[model samples]
Target: MLGAGLAHAATPEAYDPWPGLVQDIFKSRPIHDGSGVIAIEMPYRAEDAAIVPVTLRSKLAPDDGRRMLSITIVIDQNPAPMAARFELGPDANVMEISTRVRVNNYTDVHAVAELSDGQLYVAKTYVKASGGCSAPAARNADEARGRLGQMRYRQFKRPGAAGGAREAQIMIGHPNNSGLQMDQITQLYIPAFFVNELRLWQDDSLLLAIEGGISLSEDPNIRFTYASNGAKRFRAEAKDTGGHTFRNEWKIDDPGM
Candidate 1:
């Protein structure tokens, strides 16, 4: 998360932020050729700035049976550039993911995946989206605050079931108002309120912890992966920029989650 320290690839206004943002964020972890391994799905023109959907899929070959280490999502033009990060477990094998994020302006969204072998693969798409992080409040203050940190989860079959790399989808409820947003009625800037972190676990084992920012869409959604050992126990912990905290846990008898 490089604090929008972007100076596009070109120049002042013409500068594309991808090059600088990527360099700053990855630092020593340089990128290599991602020819056949990674794919990113995003619309050329995003219909909504606040809820732009982005999907990611991987093509891990049969020979590369190692579990994926992690996935990092980056929006190159937001105030805080790094949107979220997903860390996977050893038994994990799937990598299909879909999430919603904000784009302050027309920018590139990058999905970088790290394999167990420590190799990184990247996929990126330029989205024609704008004004997401600073858009006006989608909901009133009371309504947004009441639902902050609330989360929803839905499970899907892992790779073995249907031969696809998908496990579950988690949606978190939060205003994520950048504090730069203005209230329609009051015409005053909404105070900075957003979900800053999400920690997920299965039974006693930690799965992934996503550090988020204003770049995360309101009611952020993520499709993630986890191993179904014996008990399908899941837990999520979320915190907001406003200092409010929330937690939820569920146990599923079925191994699907």
Candidate 2:
């Protein structure tokens, strides 16, 4: 949310936005020793500047026989610092997740994970897209306004009844205006409006939650996996910084069954 009297400035082109970000993270959750248990997956050259996919994973030894506790994703140059955060429940085995995000400029994106034992792990990836914020919205401004807060859900079925796990993808129709883009006709900067949080659920149970920022592209897409034994439905709810919310649901009736 924009604070009073805080004017938006021209975007900057910098390589290392992590120092400040890391400092802030440390201030929030101080950790003494952290190593390389985190991993980031992204392309060196994004084929489409509009929707660059990013995946994050972590590998950690059991901490006192307990699993990792939390993971946070940060995009340095976004108007708001935090991009997404996932909390792992005891039954949660979220080794990886994929999503689309906006890259304001060339910068380093960090994935930091915290284990139950209080140890920190970090991984970094460099994304080359620049000035994505100033890029024109995917659809006409009027059209986007009409479809704001709309969302869609899809579930991918693996072969065979015993295929094991199920994967689902959620897409939201949000302009994600970064406050830096100018109206093609009016030539005035569009006000910033973007998703702030997303929650994924399975049959009334929490699967994962993501916190977003202006760094996420317009109409953001997220993919996550979970085990399905044939009878549970998937649900997702998302909220933007402007306080708007959207929800969607999908049922799983395995065709193979």
Ten-residue segment with the worst summed lDDT in candidate 2? 3-12
Off by over 4 Å in 1: 1-13, 157-166
TM-score of each: 0.84, 0.81
Candidate 2 segments whose C-alpha is farther than 4 A from its true place:
1-15, 28-36, 60-64, 159-163, 229-231, 255-257
How far does residue 167 in candidate 1 sit from its true spot (Å)? 2.6
Residue 106 displacement in candidate 2 (angstroms): 2.1
lDDT of 1 at 194: 78
Count clashing residue pairs per candidate.
Answer: 4, 1
| Backbone clashes in model 1 | 4
TM-score of 1: 0.84
Q: What is the C-alpha RMSD of each candidate to the true structure, in Å?
A: 6.6, 8.4
Residue 60, model 1: Cα distance from true site in angstroms: 1.4
Worst 10 residues of 1 by lDDT: 1-10
